[model samples]
Target chain A: MLKIIKPGLLTTVQDLGRTGYRHHGVVSSGAMDRNAHRIANWLVGNNESNATLEMTLMGPIIEVQEDALVAITGADLSPTIFGKPIANNRPIFLKKGSIIHFDRMKRGCRAYLAIGGGINVPKVMNSRSTDLRAKLGGYHGRSLVAEDILYIRKYSEHTKHTISHLRNQANQIDDFYQADWSVGRVSKIDNTYPIRVMKGRQFDWFTKESQASLVNKQFRITAASNRMGYRLDGNKLSQLKSQEMISEAVRFGTVQVPSDGNPIVLMADSQTTGGYPKIAEVATVDLSRLAQKKPGDMIDFTWITHKEAEQLLIKQEREMKQLLVGVQLRSYR
Target chain B: MEYKLSPMGDQSILIELGNTIDLATHDIVQHVVTCLDSMDHAWIIEYIPAFTSITVIYDPVQVLEIEANPFKSPYHIVANIIEEQIQQIAVLETKKQRTIEIPVLYGGEYGPDISIVAEHNHLTIEEVISFHTAGEYTVYMIGFAPGFPYIGGLPKRIATPRKTTPRSVTPARSVGIAGEQTGVYSIESPGGWQVIGRTPLELFQPNDPEPTLLQTGDKIKFKSVTKEVYDHLEAKLC
Candidate 1:
């Protein structure tokens, strides 16, 4: 069990997310960076979909009541275990009654901490994720607070074996060098500033000049952004009809341009439906990369064909599995 | 002429079918969604539909299977079959939709904008209430917030525009009109709809057996209620 000694800005419990309820208007409000979350779980031998703690730029100071193995990933936050620094990506043993804290992310916006056996939490709508909009799911359906007791799931044979193997060779992570490894970047994304977007559902609704400007321009994330979506400050994308469109299922990473003409990129906790015209969608593989972005960061869009995006996604998935195996085998060797 | 297919997370496809939401293209998009869903591909975890396009989410491991053995991904295989299926369904006509009756109490405190609606339509407040409750509204689709049905069939006379500034929080069951669309708020949320009244109906109940009272394609009819009745239901809601 872990208790939050200090609850940072907006720490919340999240998992692989709740699905099948999209038709009913529910966003899959889970960890902002899914790859980081899942990798943290894999390092601890937890199921790929296990629920974990998603810390924002500033992380919580947690007190563990039981001996466990944990991994910290994403955002490259410098963390310490009981005043001693810890490693990232690889699993490290935590002694009972030890305190873990994160100073601040030197690079990324969110970090994931996957405790061995994953965090045992109640599931709502087939997901252990927290949907802040609906105030449902994950640890009483809210953000983590001071003195919140997070439970660990009952371990399986695989989990027990993985824990024993990693702990037996715990001497490898003895370095005090905290936050060394920069995660594998989403390869060669368009850095011109406008989030690289393929033209969206209502792309044709806008004039040709707007479409060209959207591709070439650089948009800054606005202060009026949260989990619901990111409000971007750039060229306004006007619709020709200006009709009241029936709200429909809106996916994460969708760029919604409201009547105001500014584009808002929906994130982990965005609404399920919206009336804005979608100008582009963030590729699934790159969304995690997008998720790491902080407010005020500049983004540029580079349009790619559907086939290339799919191939990139499949390649990334394959790399994730390899990352899991590579870490475990390297430690043993 | 716009065709941009992007990945949404790990399990969905975002096909930018077109920009605007019109009947001619919307139906085609829906047909593609239903077709992809009807496929036998196990790798596809889920296929969700939207107004203008569909998101087809599939497992990477499943796609890798086809590449591992080319014989598996032939022309007759399930992966390629969805495109043909969509083409067939697109030409079919739309079917009958579900319709429902909704009782509403207009004017007074529940409907703060009834006067605005009446003044804009050039009708008496009583006439506005009667006309509002008389017509049947069709549920084009359910979106925005949960169970918040977007109904069509609003009279042009009462077609009031949205507030210049949206309210920070519109209470649950607050019925509002936006352009020709009239619907009830399933949850207490921020909205810009020209609210005409409130309903006792629990459109979204998270703890109930059925959370949303209405769905896409469902129809609704509004019937005027008394001040006393509105108070009784509002009291029960809390």
Candidate 2:
């Protein structure tokens, strides 16, 4: 169990998100940075889809009610246990009554905290993820607040083993003990790598100049951005010919251009259907990178073929499977 | 109707059945969705059917293996499978659809924009209500919010553009019109649609096995009722 002392910013339990609900207009609200969430869960020997706390820009101060093995992944929120700084992307054991506090963010916009046992929240529509706008799922279907107590589920076999190992090492450190070795998070911090996109169904609606500007110019993430979508401030994309469009199915990573010309990249909690013209869709492999971008962060897009995007996705999935196996092998030692 | 298939990232594909929103195109879209649903492919996760399109969300790794030994790209492979499915449904039979009659109260505080909608179409408030109730609307899609159905078949004479300044809180069950489409607000949300009436039915309930009262292929008909009847139904629902 864990108790929230200070809910610094928006914090909610998220998994892989709600699936099979878009047909009824339900948005699949989950972790913005899926890579980070998976890594955090895996490091603590939990399933990749296990619910983890998704902490934004700022993070909450949690009081550990029991000795547990846990990990912090994604953004480096300068986390400390009982006044001692802890590392990210590695499993650490927190003693009972130890308070975990997240201070200044070194990089990235979101973080994931995964305990050995997953967060036990009632699943709605076959998912434990929270959809804030719909006000459903997760911890009361909303963000975490101070004084809220979160329960942890029964630990898996691997988590039990890790917990025992962590207990043995607790005496080595004052408050907590992090494992010597660490696995790299799925997403890497590489601003040099451009965000890849594919032409959308209405790609030809935009003029040649707008098409060129979309790829060449940099767009700044505006403050209006949220889980719903990222409102990008960039060169106004003017259409060659404008026409009213029928509302159609839209998904995560869809880049929609509204009447105002600003591009809004639909995120995890985006509406299932939209009438706005979609110019491009962010590549699945690049979506995790986009999730790490904070407000005012400038980003550029590069066009990629459909085949390339699929290949990248396949490659990432293969690597993730390998990472899980590698971690499992290490646990035996 | 001719359809075009486009890739929406690696996990999903967008199938545009037609360019315009009409009954024929909507039926075709729904037909394709039904066909895909029966396929029961392991990799296929969900199908999102809209006015004139269906987006298939699937697992690339799972679907890419059936065609080849060395695992090729899933984009063209999935598209090919979908095209094959569409071809098999050439002699598609029209599926059974439900016609849900929604009881509504027109022109009251619950419907603040009813007068403006009637004025825009140059019709009396009674005529506006009659026109809306006369036509049987086809549910094109459920989107924007949970269980918010975008229904077609509004009388062309009563069609009006959406409000320029959207309301911050349009109450739930508010019947609204935007261009050629009309729908009910399943939940309280900020929207631009010109509202003309309010329904007494609870369109959505989260805990229910089938949360939404209406589905994509369902038919809808509005029945005008007195405020007394509306109150009775609303109170019963509460």
Best prediction by TM-score: 2
Docking class of 2: high
Model 2: per-residue Cα lDDT over B1-238, one tens digit each: 4888888776888888887777888889878877887887888889899878899999888886655635456877888889888888877655688899999999878778888988998999999999999988888889989999988888899899999899998989999989978899999899999989899998888778898999999988899999999999999999
TM-score of each: 0.83, 0.96
Q: What DockQ would you assign to candidate 1?
A: 0.31
The lDDT per prediction is 0.72, 0.88
Highest-DockQ candidate? 2
**Top of the candidates by lDDT:** 2
- DockQ of every model listed? 0.31, 0.80
- Compose the digit string of candidate 2's lDDT tens values, residues A1-333: 999999878999999999988898888998999988998898888999899999999989999999888999888899987677998988898888899999767798898999988999998887899999888999999999999999999899998898788778667545777888788646555667899999987899999999999999999999999989999996789788778988887888999999999999999998999999999999998888899898899989999988899889888989988988888877768
Clash counts for the predictions, in order: 18, 0
Q: Rate residue B143 of model 1 by lDDT.
A: 66
Off by over 4 Å in 1: A165-196, A202-217, A234-249, A258-262, A327-333, B1-40, B47-80, B87-97, B207-210, B226-238
Error of 2 at A36 (Å): 0.9
Summarize candidate 1's per-residue lDDT along B1-238 as a digit string, tens digits.
Answer: 2345554433455665676655555555544654565667666666555656666656655766753554532212334444455546635544444567777988778889989888888898998888888876766556666677767677777888899999999988899988777889888899899888988888876555466788654567898888787778768877
